[model samples]
Target: MRNARFEGKVAVITGGSGGIGAAVARRLASEGAAVAIGYRGNKDAADALVDELAANGGRAIAVQADAADAEQTQALIDRVVTEFGRLDVLVSCAGIEHFDALENITPDDFDRVFAVNTRGQLFAVQHAAAHMGAGGRIVLTSSVSASKAFFGHTLYAASKAAVEAMVLNLSAELGEKGITINAIAPGGTATAMAVEYGAGYLHPELAGKTSLSDWLKTQVALKRLAEPSEVAAGYAFLASDDAAYMTGRTLQYDGGMF
Candidate 1:
């Protein structure tokens, strides 16, 4: 990727309270884009982040909106444009993980994960695209599991698979309109969700018993999990004019997962 900038633009990042969402928000703001940070919960974290960014002369606002709710999702789009005057980019990072084998997974589990991860993202892009014209960008979060099956991650993997497929089709549908749609499929990222559900619980042996760092390092060919900032770097590229020619693609940010 080339050096990219978002000067004088506007971006909305869903699930912007913490983790990758917050990282992306800060990165975009630093590059001169006014950002709307949407979070379903974690007001303190979101508000504090907004304050920090504003103190640094960055434009940002924290909004409470559940991506899974179509009404609220549309409202989020309206609010970003209402505040910033125009919408240039939409990044849907809202997602949840419920790990279990196929037989152990429940219907509600499937619905809940898909509701926010896949369905919510679709509505967010739809509403954002409706408000945006040419040069609009849409980046959705996906996972390595979407392509490589992970044990006990049946539901979560399926949800990401849905996102990957939707983004491909969306790219084709939005191509004529000059709107680019793509996904960032991260692998072994150091997010709160990864710490809690992945390393902490699912792979406690890796987190507690041995050298956690070494354990995690061994899982990827590059010998480390990605920082959220690293993943956001890809988003920054996709949202910039540098990536204008790219669409219907999924950029994997894994450290070469083995």
Candidate 2:
């Protein structure tokens, strides 16, 4: 049976058009939350997911909201509240990856990654907190690169590390509001974004050993990359009552990478 942990709750998933975000949407909606898919672009994808969820008897909608912009992030939360008359969970899965060597990194690279991955989540939670009464949950997405060493993750890793900082540092602050903030660090999820940018993180030695698709499995004890749904399960836990006492920490779901 689908859990009713989120019954009568409202959620806005920024980057809901993407792989991980879409999976999170499906997970939350299945658990009985009314979901609004806030996407910067790709209306087609977002709309399709909303339709699928609705057809399955879930309440869902697709909306345009740019996560990188604080004002827009604020708008998304407010819009969901207006549409559903309540706000409860915020799962920020909107982030970009930029991998480059020390010499090849650019200032723009730093700006874009942090803008969406860090600054965006800060404001989203900031806005969402203002509306949630109590028992509100915030789940920000981090990456394995933030906690461990990964080749060419100079920019991307730093961006996510900032997110980790927020999760750790803001717990006390959010606790005052009867809310909890946490994060999830997914290792290597089999998402389109992963396949698209995974190669850019390759150092010469790893690239020389094998193709990205094959080499990735060797790094994980599970011998495979995680499905986006697996990562979504992590998000669901943080957003549900089960994690009510859990905060100021990150759930690392990286397929036992060492």
Candidate 3:
């Protein structure tokens, strides 16, 4: 069941090899958009996804860029436009998690989180919007932690909160250009990152053998963690014509945070 909602459109998803990012890439591609998967280091995964999408009859490419680097982020967009000749949507899903309290939080940690989750996303939009036309859409990924006060989430939440704020302000300016900016705030989701939660915290590269499947179920009204595809559905709506009139607001994909 493919839709032509995104036919002829081109989208670039940062952190495109991650669970949620990959899902968004597939979703947009399946709906008729030429997709670009941006990865910081996971070239293999990014390339594999591109191949899979192409095999499935979608146009895709893989590019390397660190989300935290402004120059690299700009280059990622430039390369995308070079490949597809147009930019219709930009989704920033590249983020990192650090579980430290105020006592343990350091400047480096704060900077890393904000650099990728907040600042990097801003620059990505800056580059994308310049190439976009009247019907452009920008969707940034914010986390439910931004509003939930989750344990060990001070830095992460603060960074994501900035994204929601960005959407609000960017809406007016982008709207003037006939483009839209919005966010998708997902609750505890079943992504590869959650596998790190088994270590008693969320974030890749942490010590863990446990997953969030059981623990996260208690955090939301829904009894299970959301799948990457479920979060992608929300992103798809924001990036499509269905939400053309919507801007400056976040589609809360949270499973009723409790």
Candidate 4:
């Protein structure tokens, strides 16, 4: 494959301010794509990333938009088209995970998780589809929790499960347009969110017992957490022309964590 696989393309990545999203943005931009970083609140981080990309001879812009809001989501696509004059790739990486057991889950929490993880992804693809032509690639971020029964992830898993289903239906609907829609389901990754969720981290209370991180590692064949860049590489592949024949499938980059 060419080093500049994304050259002359334009990509919009939601939640590009940090974590897997930021890693994807950086990888795409480095490969010569004009990237628009969609951020909800952290303008500083977004601006800093844009500047860093520019400094490294990459074309990038930072846009402020909340993925949970339908209007803002549409506006995000519009802003990217206005700035870059086209949209070739859309990566819906904006998501929030609120872990609550079934008995403790709230209605608001359910709505919040679906608002960004599920609804946001749908609208992002719907609007981006309008601007994309042949060869457009859409990548959605999902999680292993979508299929695996994880503790305190009822709401989060449900939202991602919806995304996985949507990818299949949308692939059939959009295939004629030559647009490929797929998803990446990552396992325990070394991101700030992972730390907050007790992945690959030491907890004092669980010191004597089996820690969450230890238990998770043992479950994975790799026996380790995946790095953000490792997950981003999956996004890069799906967004590239090399993955043209693959669609409607959720690629699991979960360190063999089924």
Candidate 5:
């Protein structure tokens, strides 16, 4: 029998109920990592995914945890460790996007965005790092919008930029413990979050000029939005031994949007 890449590993994916998070959970489990999926409010979806993985002969479990809450985030890490015995990979894919003009952006909205996208991811790592030993890998989800200027994306962009910065800083801190920290910045993925943002909310200036779908295609060299699995593949690679030497860098999987 051919050996799987992660035969003896365990992985935890935040926001693993859907979109990129679900895709990553599937990918890691298929590669032989026992996976624990963390979801905020979608217990049904998370449970369904766990069933699907089991049907395919892969091991998986679902846990309910709000990433935006630090205590809950730490509990998530603890739950994964308890279930799988040890954690080898941590993929922080839980995030939110709030698109609104600067004049209309509320303090609460800004804080909420940062709470999930930045602060939550930071603590997830901080706590997960405790259980992760040598050869542990941490991959964060960032967005191409962080570096690109988009109307009404000030808060979302700022939060993601902070994520990338955290990846760089944590790499050095975690390196001494033999852990690798990195991020994947995707551009215009066709996830539910992206579709909602594209169809319903856009900058006031471009509101009626064109559809968000068409506008996004024109911006990407590929002329199309990425699939969740495509972005998940990058996460898989970064989590594997093949990327052991890589850390503190953000890989742009934006379909050449940069």
Candidate 6:
């Protein structure tokens, strides 16, 4: 049973069709918040999630949008507010990753990554902040790669680093608005993106077999990779009234990986 704690809140989750975004959308909706899910592709998955939420007596809509596009991002925020009557929470989980050495990374890949991870996040927050009132919450999905200089992740790491910086800056700017902006930097978890990225180097299904808990035991103090739901718990807390005093912080949830 869910806590049923967000009885009257409204939330918007970008990249909500899959992975951590979908987990967070379900979590928030289960807790009683109305959710508008944003997706770039995967229309079927997005619609299915909306239907699932509605069938379970939760309010939800799947809006097609590319976070990398400013106009589309703004329109997504407008649609959520229009449908829900208000926007209280914003979860920016749309991102792209490319695995390549620093020298081999192309300009296009670097630009695309930043366009979604950093620029897109900024624009999403900008539009959401304009519509949100006091006590509004903004959560960006960052990664531990932001801080770790992982090999073959030069572009991806650079993009995540920018996102971390944005979260801190946005928190300071939005303080007067009574809105809190924060980020979550999670370590490796089993997701489609991870699977695709790891397939060439490892087995095709290696990502699926691996769990955050397994990694946590070795490199992480906690001995695991974080489940998407586990990361979603952090989003829930940050979005809740319980975290009212918190802002401009990045909660690293990588099983205590240093």
CA lDDT of every candidate: 0.88, 0.89, 0.89, 0.91, 0.91, 0.86
Better of 1 and 2 by TM-score: 2
- Of candidate 6, the 10-residue stretch with the lowest lDDT total is 198-207
Q: Is candidate 2 or candidate 4 better by lDDT?
A: 4
Q: Give the lDDT of residue 252 in candidate 6.
A: 90
Over 1-258, each residue of candidate 4 has an lDDT whose tens digit, in order, gives 548999999999999999999999999998999999999999999999999999989999999999999899899999999999999999989998776668998888888889999999999999999999999999998888888886667789899999999999999988989999999999888888887875323334554588666776668899888899999999999999999999999999999974
Please provide, for model 2 over 40-110, each residue's C-alpha lDDT reduced to its tens digit, 9 standing for 90 to 100. 98999999998999999999988898888999888888889888998999999998887777998888877
**Cand. 5 Cα-lDDT:** 0.91
Off-target runs (Cα >4 Å) in candidate 3 are 198-214
Clashing pairs in 2: none
Cα error, candidate 1, residue 24 (Å): 0.4
On residues 1-258, what C-alpha lDDT tens digit does candidate 5 reach at each position? 634888989999999999999999999998899999999999999999999999988999999999999999898899888887999999999998787778998889988999999999999999999999999999998988888887778899999999999999989999999999999998778888876776544456677888877776667688778999999999999999999999999999988873
Candidate 6 lDDT tens digits, 162-217? 88888888787899889999998977766787766633223235557765345346
Q: Write the per-residue lDDT of candidate 3 for residues 27-110, one digit (tens) a residue.
A: 999999999999999999999999999999999999999999999999999999999999999999999887776899999898
Instruction: At residue 149, give the lDDT of candidate 5.
Output: 84
TM-scores for every predicted model = 0.93, 0.96, 0.93, 0.95, 0.95, 0.91
The per-residue C-alpha lDDT of model 6 at residue 90 equals 96
Whose TM-score is greatest here? 2
- By TM-score, the better pick of 3 and 5 is 5
Which residue pairs overlap in candidate 3's backbone? Answer: 198-210
User: What TM-score does model 5 achieve against the real structure?
Assistant: 0.95
Poorest lDDT segment (10 consecutive residues) of candidate 3: 198-207
* Angstrom error at residue 38, model 6: 0.2
At residue 207, what lDDT does model 2 achieve? Answer: 71
